[model samples]
Target: MPDNFNFEAAPFDTLSEYERNLLRSALSVGYYVPGETLIEPGSTTLALYIVLKGVVEERGKDDQLFAHYGPDDLFDVRGLFAGQTRHAYRAVEESIVYELNAKMFHELCERNAPFASYFQASLAAKRQLARRDGQNLAEFILTRIAREHLLPAVEVSADLSLGEAARTQLEVGADALLVRLEGGFEGLGIVTRTDLMAAHFQRRLSDDTPVGTLAHQPLAVVELGDFLFDAMILMTRQRIERVVVRQGSQPVGLLHLTQVLSLFSTHSHVLALRIARAETLDELQRAAETLDTLIATLEGNGIRLRFIMQLVSALNEQLLARVFEQSVPAAFRSRCCLVVMGSEGRGEQLLKTDQDNALIHADDISSEDALTWMAHFNEALKGFGYPQCPGGVMASNALWCKSVSEWRHELQTAAQEGRPEQLLRLSILMDAYPVAGNEHWFSSIQAQLSTWSDQGERWLSDMALAALQFDTPLTLFGGLKTSGERLDIKRGGLFPIVHGARILALRKGLMVRGTLARLQVLGKHGVLDQHMADNLAETFELFVQLRLSQQLAGDRSGLRQGLDVSRLSRAERDLLRFSLHVVKKFKQTLGRQFHLDTR
Candidate 1:
């Protein structure tokens, strides 16, 4: 290796002899002159690069500049990732880069599990950013704003030539570059590998061709104050590969399309797709068994608990749809919607949880035969491993399976009157998320939801009153509250966040379906700040993982000791304890925001 040649780009500090030899053999090392274009804007190169020296710049083109990156930051990863190039890159100074050809990178990762694991996550993050807009917009209006969503900006003014830009992208292994424009922050534009290719094809163009000529303007930006859904929308509508994430003018992060979607992929995608393809109920069960294996894999890999819930939510929705498809009549299926309650509704489900579901059917055309078919549908889902809804929320329960008019009346009556039965009815039903069929039915009911938002201050008061139904298990001494021997992470940590997010969202006319989603939207309205909402979202996620690990371990070890609060590893216990405080603080925030009567 040449002097000053080092591999800070590698994720780990020390490498085994075999790995070092692999890197040495497979790697092509080179030094870039200052102002040499490392990668042309718009040219998609299927290679990963490691920077050994000097600064590299990543700028967004066409109004959605991503975060600027430097030494130790991997770039052009998407080239290594499924071989798609999205951004433009350049080096700010003379730089040295290790060009790990795509084929070599794949081989190295495949041979080394530790390296492969990190590589998988890195690639997954990119893919997620590519596919985030698939979510229903209306349903996401209430999600939490996350710190990760911040657009990253570096404060520097180094104008490198197009040649240098290309070289830098290759050096940092980045897919794109976002250059700082002289005017406003959003005035920043980006250049991609595609642009570089365009430059390459134009033989008249010189390495000295001012990259700024090709720099697209108006980097797409969402404020730190913007809701997460807004970020989702910007990504979805723009159709570009990444977003210029920002907090005011300063870039704090890059919201890569691939990274966002990776959050919901993994096991859930596997289960959902497999279950969809299965033809028989028995086949569905076999596919679902794959979930157990998936869970074990997830636990072994050590992903956070909150992310697991996202996987579970995606999987549950997928599994439910498959079950409904196999059992429900095609014509009637579109006329009905599946509603999940309890933990599933609150986005806190962990492990394989019990079912809390209800169905809503169109009122005008139901016959006894229709009822029979719906009943069979419910039973089919149960057999496929989603236990039937407790408390009769299942479609088989006549009280719960009502027509559109009936459902509206029930919610309106519950809100207007404030009786024990009505409160219980609304409480059980409010968190409903429609999974399959004529979402129009759910949308119709959603229109009515606003009816209470403006006029029903009393109803808001009542819901806030009922919100206290779920409690944080914080004890008198200010430590975590215990339920018998094991701490009830769900009630103590998760529920408070869910309920607070829910009540705040509902009171604000935010009709989002998930807790984090709700907090996200509310944050945009100044109802909750970004950090406040994200902390609560994190709290809910941590509790879920703790409880889920306990549940999964219980089934495997037969040690129903529950989660040993004290026995937890230091990291796990610390995260849980911190999350506990997050939930506690969030509950108080909700009460203050809603102005609920303490009495």
Candidate 2:
């Protein structure tokens, strides 16, 4: 292997040592200058080319650039397999590429199933393969209950005396004991340490009392194949310490919150605990400072990007809620609803960006009073690291902090006017998630908005069209167009996937918030085929991962929204190009579905 080459890159990464040796033995080098054509259209495939330095452009029959290959990037694999070239490869910059004979490449592919799959699989399949490759790094969180060792269940007959049940639990060193039902109930019930202590302290039962009288159904339960994270989420949501682990109809064991927490000591649970315990702004500020460190820790531990995004989002919501709780007066807080919009609303925010928030005050509350508290709330967030919204979309703005009736009127006006910008604002509001105060208020607004969207075809079409405003960074011939050294992954790839899904959800009357959840719901309802939904989900995740990697690497200097492609590894670049292609297909589908092309 060359000094610059790493195992994480493409076909080489999937190859066995023997196959890699075969590849290494057959390697040869070729160099080309800018505009020099390496393979002309309709030419026979002679070799597989892997760029060692500089850039290669693949141009289509129309002489339009479609794709670009940079250092450690591979090209011409499909052409080699087809035994002819469909497009021309030209040097975009002075470039050096390593060549391996097509015959040897064929032999290697024939010998290695994974190596062949890496080249021939769909983008979604490739992404799954990549995930599996790093499975060990993230397995503690993603692993299924069936894979982990479950604590043995300690069961006592419902008729057993409390003394006997307590002795059994103590003897078994179990934190909880199961009461097996005999006649009345069909399922077993669980009794925990707290339950036993509460019963004893309240003098509600005697030691001779039947255990059945004290037993109740478990707070939560998970099946054998369910991921640990699901169980953790349940425990977190319910404020419970453990959940019953079951296999089929039989009880397997218990999954304790402590077990999951022990595995992820640096998880969001710490932030959540801090938020819940914080009574003052100073303490919350101290807690907020740990967020960047938490993100860095989780990313370094190789947690899946989506899960990391969710964790960060959950933490952010807690931070915001705490700030709202501290900064807003109690009298006003109960009458108002605080919502987070944009990426934060969708639970896809991976970094602390601008504050996209609004307040929905009760009809009786004055807008002046709401704005005063909202200003304090917004300033508090700024002190905690969230910058003010550039477009003045924060709750502090008088226009945003409005009475319920006022917000309803604003939505009606925006939908009725049908201006492109107004529709765009309406789309942002569509993603709103209530983080603090009265959630019912926000839900009522959402219900109204859903009804309005159902009748607003022009509004939906305009929103969908906004997703296509930015041309995909990759040209028709597969070459990536860059703005200086930066490419805006957000606009080029993320927006189309997000807004397209949002539009689809609107038309279907689906109320889900996250992009992936919307796609899943759409797929479940047969609005989107499962394969296409999975492909889009994976593609969106890839774009998020790339942007996150860029942010985490401290590369946010010029063009804050752009990702510098030159800094990525060969495998990452390949995945990025494939992901971008997926985005292009997604946008084309959206345009056709929404009649954007005709408009």
User: Which one wins on TM-score?
Assistant: 2
TM-score versus the correct structure, for each prediction: 0.55, 0.86
Full-model lDDT for every candidate: 0.63, 0.80
Q: Which candidate leads in lDDT? A: 2
lDDT assessment of candidate 2: 0.80
Model 1, span 290-387: residue lDDT tens:
77676666654555444545555666676777777876788788878767777777655655556677777788757464467668877776676666
In candidate 1, position 234 carries an lDDT of 52
Could you give candidate 2's per-residue lDDT for residues 59-137 as a string of tens digits? 7877877677877778798898899999999998999988888989899889988778888887766765565433454
Off by over 4 Å in 1: 1-270, 346-348, 469-471, 556-562, 593-598
Q: Judge candidate 1 at residue 303 and give its lDDT.
A: 50
Residue 370 lDDT in candidate 2:
82
Cα displacement (angstroms), candidate 1, residue 546, comes to 1.4
TM-score of 1: 0.55
Flag regions of model 2 displaced more than 4 Å: 1-8, 30-44, 53-70, 88-96, 128-135, 152-165, 177-191, 198-218, 247-251, 328-336, 419-421, 475-477, 524-531, 555-559
